[model samples]
Target: MTARSTQNKRKRFDPVLLLVLLLIVFLTGLLVQVILATDYLGSGLGDDVARFQDLSGVESPVTAVLLNFRGYDTLLEVMVLLMAVVGVWSLTRAPFPKKPIEPGPIQLAVVRLLAPLMVLFSFYLVWQGSHLAGGAFQGGAVLGGACVLMLVSELPWLKNISSRFLRIGLLSGPLVFLGVAILCIVLQGTLLDYPQEWVGTLLLLIETACAVSIGLTLACLFAGGRPKDDLSGGRKR
Candidate 1:
């Protein structure tokens, strides 16, 4: 076709694109108007705060809302993250490199110094969540950061860890959370309904398991595939 004819043909297709753009703009304007008209924000916060102390049984309002008032939300979120990791695992398993990359001396020094601190900080965050802003997700992220550091530094012991153990580590959190949920149903006749007296202890157990599981899952994701089993003789000791 001639250049001018080609340009005309392209213009013919432009109307469909223009209609989509106009539709998107109209939807955006409608959404904005709805948001502007809503008067629930302040009232909602006040309501949540007023009932927080009694409803949550925890000092931290955020924790109370997440792990108690809306515990199922957190459970589903954890399951979603686990599902994502499972999907990644099913895609492809990359071969372990013959010679692992070694971090420089400064990198090694920093990792050695920082890894322990990160672990300690992660636990502190998880423990503090009952009365503070930190929680299992934040603590798990910190722990994952520590694992990344260890992986990059090529720590001998870390490299030698068996794949089965790694899989268990990645799965521990979800398993524990699911188990607790089932136990609640069996013991309390409702999902996640802990007895008032046992709330704190049960919460602590769930958070600790979740934190460790999240940490390992995140670290395995960073490594990009399931680790090779040391016993399989795929990797040299």
Candidate 2:
């Protein structure tokens, strides 16, 4: 039986198929690298990597590539976030049954002390993301973790997080991505291809919106309850 189970698991993985896929991916990567190295993408975006070249403190070419050259990937990333919100919402639909599980006082106290700080930290990450490494996804996940902690404590105040806001927060990034893409087409004759005049401002604007929406949507999901119409029993303070 043990040998049979091991063989079944091995069959499921199909190492030969995985190796073939890996080989294909490697070949594709090699092709892209060669293309970029040859300046086939124009001027080697890496030229802008230096602080002297990007005096405004951003790696302009990198930002441009993300929002323009590789914009399809960014759009798909936004879509993934949208789907996550939709999936979670569908999974925890109406008639939210109370599971009768209450946190112990000790746990509740810990949550009360920790949740707000975590949320604040998430905002910090969002705010610093423009020129720094962190961004909306990282910050939002942190905020969501805080919301889950608060929800676990069954605190009513925390439960009053607005449902309308939740929906907006969940959809904001994708909406902005779509909006910007459309605007770029209107202005530049190509989708997501921002005008050179507006590149810096546009990147900042999109990043901010993505951060806030990511934070709010994820937090709402973590909170689990439908965004409140009334906090009858969930009041925080």
Clashes of each: 0, 5
TM-score for all predictions?
A: 0.84, 0.62
Q: Which residue runs of candidate 2 sit more than 4 Å off their true CA positions?
A: 1-57, 60-69, 94-113, 158-162, 220-237
Q: Supply candidate 2's per-residue lDDT for 194.
A: 70
Model 2 Cα shift for residue 85 (angstroms): 2.1
Give me candidate 1's TM-score against the actual structure: 0.84
On a 0 to 100 scale, what is the lDDT of residue 202 in model 2? Answer: 75
lDDT of each: 0.80, 0.66
lDDT by residue (206-225, candidate 2, tens digit) is 76677677766666556553
Candidate topping TM-score:
1
TM-score of decoy 2: 0.62
